[model samples]
Each structure stands twice: as C-alpha cells, then as structure tokens.
Target chain A: MDIILSNSSDQPFYQQIKSQIKQAILRGTLREGELLPSIRNLANELQVSVLTIRRVYSELESEGFISSHTGRGTFVSTIDSELIRESMRHLVEQDLQKVIQDAKAYDISQAEIIDMIRVLFEEDL
Target chain B: MSTVLTVKQLQKSFGSFELHDISFDIPKGCITGLIGVDGSGKSTLIKCLISLIRRDSGQVEFWGMSIDDAEQEIKNRVGLVMEGNNFYDNLTLHETKELIENAYPNWNEMIFQKYWGCRDYHYSSRTLLSSLSQKEKLIFSISLALAHNTDLLILDEPFCGFDPVDCSEILVMLREYIQDENHSILISSPSGMEISSIVDSFIMLDDGELVFHMDKDHLLESHMLIKGATSLLGNIPVSEFIKLDIGNYGFTGICNDYNKIKPYCADLDLTVERTNIADIMMAYMWRRGNVI
Candidate 1:
C-alpha cells in the first residue's frame, strides 16, 4: 500500500489518506481480511500526527471499507461487487466533472465534448 | 478526554517579568506544542509545571498529583529534555549513565542500549560529554528519559541548535515514543512552523500572557491570508483582522475567520490562501504590535 501526500494540495491531509486507501480497496489492491498496519506505525511512516491516522482509520471503518478488532488490529472489509462498481463510476464522474468545468471555461460545447470522447474511445478499442 | 497533566492559574514572577494566569492541559496521547516568541514566559511556564522553579501561585497537577504531594512518583514518570546545560561536561557518557541509573529506579538497561547503539547515535560510552556534538547529547538525554519509562515528556526548546536533518531525527524519535496511547509530550519552540505537522494542538503565549489554545485542524482551517488592493480594505472594519499590512502596491492581512470576511470580498478582488502556524503566530504578534 503506497500513499503519496502533496503539501501544495488544497485537500486536507486526513482526506488525502482516506481517499487513497478507499481507492486501493475499490481497485482490489488491498484484499479483504488483509491486516492493515497499526495506526501508530502508519502515522510514524507518514510523519503525521497519530491523531490524524486515528481519524482516517475511524472514518474508513465507518464507511464500510475497514473494521477493527479489539487486540487483533484493523483489517480491510469484504466489499461487494456492486459497491465496487458504484465507487468506480463515482471516481469516473469526478474526473469527468473536472473536464467539464475546464471545457466550459474554454467555451467548448457539450456536443464537441461527446465527439472528442467518441474519437478517444474508438482509438482505445 | 483524559488529561496527563493539568495546570490552573499557574503564575510565576522573576523580578519584573511574570507569567499571568497561565492554564492549560496536556491531553493523553497527544503532542501539544508551546509556541511563543522570546521572553514569552514559555520557559517559565515549563519550569513551574515541572516544579524546577517555585510558582508564585496557582495549581499544577500531574496525573492528579502535585509535585509537593508526590514528588518522587511524579519524577519517576515524567521526563524532562532541555536543550543544554543539564549534563556535566567533564564526565564520560558511561559515568553519566551510572548517575542517571541510580536516580531513576525504573531505568531499563536494554532500552538505553537500544538507542545508544542505534545507527543515528552510535556514541560510545567512553566518549566524554564535552566532546559529543549537540545533537548527540540531545539523543543521549532522550534515550535516558525513555529508559526510565516516562509517561509524559516536557521538552524546552529541544530543537534550538540542530539543522533540519538533525531536527527531523529528533521528531522521528518523538513520534516513535508517542506510539503508545498512554504517553504524551509537551514541546516548546519559538519556531512553530517546524513542528506544525506533528502537533495535535497548540498553546500560544505572547508576552507572559495566554493568547489561545486551539486544535491544529481548526486553527489552520479557520484563518486565511488575504491579499489585494489597499483601497478595497477600506470598508472592512479594522477589528476583523489580526495583522493588516498596507503597502503602496497593495495589501496583505490575516483574518481571524474566513467566513466572516467572505461577504466583504464579493466585489473586492482578493487572493485568499490557507495559513500555516508561522503566519498565524505573526498575525497574533502584529495584532499586539510587538514585531521585534
């Protein structure tokens, strides 16, 4: 599990960690039942406050991406296929939203964007 | 929330200098940074908290026990790491270790050996305290403190003389020490920016007075750095800002709360950026009109 944080990013540090871990779980890179690093260990590795790591872990647990056991430590949760598909779609929608905003700033029409997407999709196929 | 140490109306005076009604808590399992400029009474507060010097008034409790009531018990569990002047220069490391071992009954030889033998601090026991570098001495002091199984650490400007690399090494050791939820640290520094990332909260002092105690997340989130035309700031009340600098070219200022200033910025073109601890410190100082 690799997490890279950018200091210049507008996103808060805890939010950055939470999103990266969520993406890893959705992509199947972190398998279900895989024991995650201890919160303190992760905090030390990232050079962030232990409280920040605790917040990230608790938020992830609440969101159904992970769960913790009393002395056994935290582990990734078994995510359903439908949830994974939904999350993937959400991620794509976020990227598309950024592209749409940029296009509007440059005064590009929706039809032109659809045409460009069609060309790019066919080229990949 | 459980607190490791609690201070109430802690007051101390040295001739004309004084700490006025200083009070705060060191929460369990959190790193709290004491931020203040020179002569801000940070050192005096730490001294009073640890019972190094007598406080003129107020109550300080460590785990609910005052130093006068449980001096031995408190000394056993609390660690003190000052920048310099604690150790004897004429003694070898081995001799000093022996003295510390006798002072603290709970000292663990194994823990001391682990840190003393680590790659970053491979100082031999035969090395004299006077010959070791400042960083090495600091490492040794901290290692000894850890060996005694201290639950709370009070550090006074421990990062004063180190370069960035050496300073980070100290930070890494501190983070490792704080892994256990029972341990807590209260570190003081004039430069708050250096330790901003690791501190869970901040206790800011200005000229022997308590300025504010705030959580790190809220402190950084609520304040903002605004820069734009000086003419645009004419409408905004002066009381809204802690520091407002008006230059011939434009203006830059620090607002206490971004939400309150949002309405004023509707027609005024301004560049608003998130603030760091240093900027916040400067803003508070500028508000007090103490820029020295």
Candidate 2:
C-alpha cells in the first residue's frame, strides 16, 4: 500500500493516512486478509510518529475495516457486502444532496429533477 | 504506556536561575522533545538527569532504579549526546571509539560502523577529534551513543550546528533507533520548528518552569492563531485567548482551544490558521516582554 502525506494540507497526518487507507479498502484496492505494514514500518515509511500510526490502526480495527493478531500483523477485514452497498449509497446521498440543493435554488421542481436524472442516467447507459 | 525514565519534582539552582519542581516521564517508544529558549534551564535539567551536575533535590529513576543507587547501571543503558565534545582533542576518532567501546559492556562494533556509513554521513574513524568540525563532532557524539545497546537516548541540542540535510539524516537515524517499542529518546532544543515534525510530544519550559506538556497532535489540532480587526475582538470572549496582541491595524491572539471560538471566527470574518510550535513559543516569550 502507498500513502503520501502533505504538511501544507489542513488535515492532520493521522487523518490523512487513515482516510487514504479507508478509501483504498473500500475501493477494493486492498483485499480482505491482505497484510498491512507493521506500525513501526509504516511510521518509518511515512516519517510520522509510531503513536500516530498506532492510532490509525486501532481506529480502523474498531471500525471493522481491519484486524490485528498478536505476533502476526494487521490485515484488512472481510467487510460485509451490505456495508459496502451502504457506503456506496451514503456517497451518492451526499452528492445528490448537493445536486438537490442546487436544483431547488434554480426553482426546479422535484418531478422535473427526477425526470432530468432519468434522462441523464439513460444517456450514460 | 511504560515509562523508561521518570523525573519527580526535580530541582536545581544556579545563582538566580533555577529549575523549580520539574517533573515528567519519558514514555517508551516515543520521542519527547524538550523545548525551551536559551537560559530556560534545559541544559541544567539534562545535566542533573545524567548526573553530570548534581540536583539539589528530586528523584531520577530509570526502569524503576533510582539514579542515586544505580548510577552506573542506569548510565550504561542510557546513551547521551550533549552539545560539546568532551573527548580529548589529541585522540583520533578510532582512539576515542576504543575508549567508549571499553566503557560499555553492551557496545556493538557493528552498530558503530553502521552509523558512520549511514545515509550520507560517510564519516571515517581515522580522523582526529581536534580536526572534526562542530557539525561532524555532533554527528560523532550521536554515533557513539547509538553504538551501545542503550534503551534510552538523551540528546541536548544535537542539531544546533547541523545543516538542514544533516538534521534530516540524524532525525531518520533517531526514528529508526526507536522502532523497538522498548526504546525511547529525550531531546532538548531551543528551537521547536527544527524538531516539531518528528516529536511525539512536547515539554515546553519557560523561565526554568514547564509551561505545558502535551501531545504534539493535540497541541497542533487545538491551538490556532486568530487575527482580525481590533473591533471584532469585542464580539468574542477575549479572556479565552492564551496570548493577545492588539495593533493599530489589527489584533492577533493565540487561542488554546480554537474549537471554542471557531464559530466567532466564522461569523466575525476573523482569519484563523493552525498555530505551530514556534508561534506558541514566541507568544509565551513575548508575554513577559522578552525579546527572545
């Protein structure tokens, strides 16, 4: 797994790494049961504190995205299909929320917006 | 977290200068940066901890062994790299290496050899100590410390004379050294910006007293520099600021918890940015009219 960090970005280092890893896992770039780098190894690679990486690993573990075994190492968890579908729905909901807000500002009715979505969806297909 | 070294109510006095009731723990697998300006008793505190200078009162413990009772044993497991080069000038690097090797029973010749050739250092053991530049001497000192199987490394302003490239190399070396969860480091420096990126936590000292001891991430996340027109200051709780400076054109303040005043910043059109260790240090220094 590759992670890049930016000191100039507003997000803290830990958050950046955590989000990137989560995105990778969700996108299926990281497969289930795939081993993650050791905390020390990842910390060295990122030039971040070991504690920061530990926090990321612990949080990801708690969120059910990963799991750790003693004397072994961290690995991506086998996420439920429902969780993945829910996450995908959540992402669309966020984007659609913005689109609805924009449509409402333009005085577009809900039926009209639905019609436009249907037309665009069919065109893309 | 397990503590590698604990200093309890450590006190020392030198004429008008004194470190009053200094206390803190060096947690294992972490790099604790001791940040304070010059004359802040950083060196004095380090001396007392290393027993280079005796403390007036306090308990210094390493792995639960008091320094008073097991000074040699504790020293053996602790690596020290201070500012000055105490090795004899007449001695060649090889000669000094032999002396240090004989002193520590756990000394590893491989580690010593690896350090000199590590990164871009390319240091030779055949050079004379008197001929080495200040930067080279500092590197040599650190190399000596890491040569032993030490659990904790104590560095006092080790980057003072180093160039930026040299500093980064040393930082990487130190980071690699602490990969083992049992190892730790305590480093002292006048400038926080130099070590801010690598330190896990910061112990800030001002006028011989610890101003605050906090995790680096927590400090960075919470503290912010708020700037806006002087008139906008009236709309917010001015008392919440740790340090405030009012100017004719505008006002600038350091907020200990930016989240508390974040709403005001958004509503009042105040410019709020993440504050760094250097900014916090400057505000504290100027709080009492110190030009440092």
Candidate 3:
C-alpha cells in the first residue's frame, strides 16, 4: 500500500496514517488477509516512530478492519459490508452538517439548503 | 512494550552543572531523541547512560538487569556512536577497525567492508580518521555501529557539523537499521528540527531537569501557537497561555493544551496554529524563565 505524509499539515501524524490506511481498505486497494508492514518497517519507511505505527495498528484492529498475530505480523481483516456502509454514511453526514452550517452562516433558508442538497444528490446519481 | 534500557533518577554534578533526577526509558523498536540546548545536560546524561561518566546516584537497567550485573552484556549489546574520533589519531580506518574487531564478538568483516564503500565517504581503509572531515568522522563512527550486531545504538550530537543532505543521509541510515522490532536507538541533539521528523518520541531538557517528554503525535496535537490582537488577551484567562508574549503590533504565544482551550479559542474567534517540535520545546523554555 502507498501512503503520503505532510509535516506541516494541521492533522496529527498518527491520524494521518490511520486515515490513509482506513481509506485504502475501504476503497478496496488493500485485500483482506494481506499481511501489513511490520511496525518497525513501516515506521522506518515513513520516518515515523514505531510507537506511532503501533498505535495505528491498534486503532485499526479495534475498529475491526485489521488484526495482529503475536509472532507473525499484522494483516487486514475481513471487513463487514454493514460497517463499510455505516462508515461512509457517517462521513457524508459530517460533510452535510458542514454544508448546512455554512448555508446557515450565509443566510440561506433551511428549505433552500435542502433544495440545493436535493439537486446535488440527483446530480451525483 | 519491551524496554531495552531504563535510567531511573540518574544524577550527575560538575561544579555548577548538575543533572537532576532524570528518568526515562528506551523502549525497544523505537527511536527516541533527547533534545536540549547546550549546557542543558544532554551530553552529561548520555555520558552517564553509557557509563563514561559515572552517575552520582541512580539505577541504570537493561533488559531488567541492573548496570552492575549487566555491564559486560550491555557493552556487548549496545553500540555507541559519538561525533568524535576517540581512537588513535594516527591509526588508519582499516587499522582502527581491526583493533576493535575483537571487542565486538559478533563483528562481521563483510559488513564492515559493505559500509566502507559508502558514496562520497572514501573510507578506502588506508585514510587516517584524524584527516577526515566532521561529516566523514561521523559516517565512520556510525558505520562501526552498523558493523556490530548491536541491538541498541546510542548517539550523541551526530548532526553537529554537516550539510542538510549529509544530515538526512545519516537519518535515513539510522532509520533503516531499526527496521526490526528487536532493535532500538537513543540519540541526543540540540537541533530538534533536524531529527524531529525521524524520532518517534522526544524528551526535552532545560537547565538540568527534563522539562517534558512526549510522543511525537501527542506533542503536536496537545499544544498550539495562538496569535491575536494584544487587546484580545483580556478576554482569555492569564493562565491559559503557557508563555504569552505581547508586541506593539499584536500578541503571539502558545496555548499549552489545544483541547482545553479549543472552546475558548472558538468563543473569542482566535486562531490556534499547530505546534512544531522546535516551537513546543521553545515554549517550555520560555515558561521556565517565564519571560519571552
């Protein structure tokens, strides 16, 4: 898998790593049961600390997107379709909330904001 | 986490300079950096850790074994690379390597030969170490570390005299060495910006005390630089900013905890910028003197 990091970005480094891996898994770029990079290897590759990578793996495992074997290594887990859908819905809901907030800030009416969303939704299909 | 080395309440004194009750762990599989300005006890602490200068008091342990019990084992397993030529000034590179070969039982002739040909290093073996430049000296020192089958590497001020490219070259080499979870490294340097990108955790020192220690991500996430008009300072709590500085144009300072002041920042329409390692350490330094 490929990953990119920016030191100057506002986001924390660990969060950047976690999100990139999650996105890759969700987008089907990474296959289930595929062995992931060892914590030290990944840390070296990214020029980050092994602790940070360990935290990333732990977070992924807790989210059920990956799992680790004691002596072997970490691997992607079989993801649930329901979880994928729920995660996507949650992301979109957050975006929609921001859109609503911006609309309200710009003095747009609730009905007008809903109408705009409807138009955008139809266009997306 | 499995700790490779633990220094508990390590203390040392030399007239006016004293390292006061410093304790930290070098966990396996991680690169830990000690950052402090000159005379901040970075070198003293490292000297004590390696037993070059005995600590006045405190316990140093490796693999749960005390220093007294594991001195030989620790010497065998831990490699030290300082940016200086403590070897005989007249000895050639090959001669020096030959002398130290028996000291490290696991030393490989082939591994030594591999690093001997580093690009632009000209470690042709016949060249005397005393004639080498600062950068070459450091490269040779680190190459020696790599040649041994050491699990833990200790470095002190290895980035002092080098171009940016050379500094990065050293950083990359160190990173590649710890690709396995069995190895660890502890490095000390005054230039936080140079090694901060590669270090997993950071320990900050000022005067003789450890001002703070933190994970890289946590340090960046916890604090931020807050800037606004000096007049706006009245709206926020005096204690909110760790080291507040006011200017005629405006005011700029650091908020110690971004999470705690996020709502306060929002309520006052203030901007909180992400803190860099250098700035974070500087903020603490400012707090110590309580003046900027």
Which candidate model has the greater lDDT, 2 or 3?
2
Instruction: List model 2 lDDT by residue over B141-241, tens digit each.
Output: 88899888888999988888678887887787787787777888899889788888678888988888988888787787677788999988889998778
Q: What are the interface RMSDs of all the models?
A: 2.5, 2.4, 2.1
DockQ for all models: 0.36, 0.43, 0.63
Cα lDDT, model 1, residue B135: 81
Could you tell me the fnat of model 3?
Answer: 0.69
Q: Is candidate 1 or candidate 3 better by TM-score?
A: 3
- A70, model 3: CA deviation in Å? 3.3
- For model 3, residues B20-65, the per-residue Cα lDDT tens digits are 9998887888888899888898988887887888899999998888
Going through the candidates in the order shown, the clash numbers are 0, 0, 0
Candidate 1 residue-wise lDDT, B158-272, digit = tens: 8886798998888888887887878988998996877876788889999899998887766775677788888777777656788888899998888897777867764576777
Order by TM-score, highest first: 3, 2, 1
- What are the Cα lDDT values of the candidates? 0.84, 0.84, 0.81
Look at candidate 2 and give me any clashing residue pairs. Answer: none
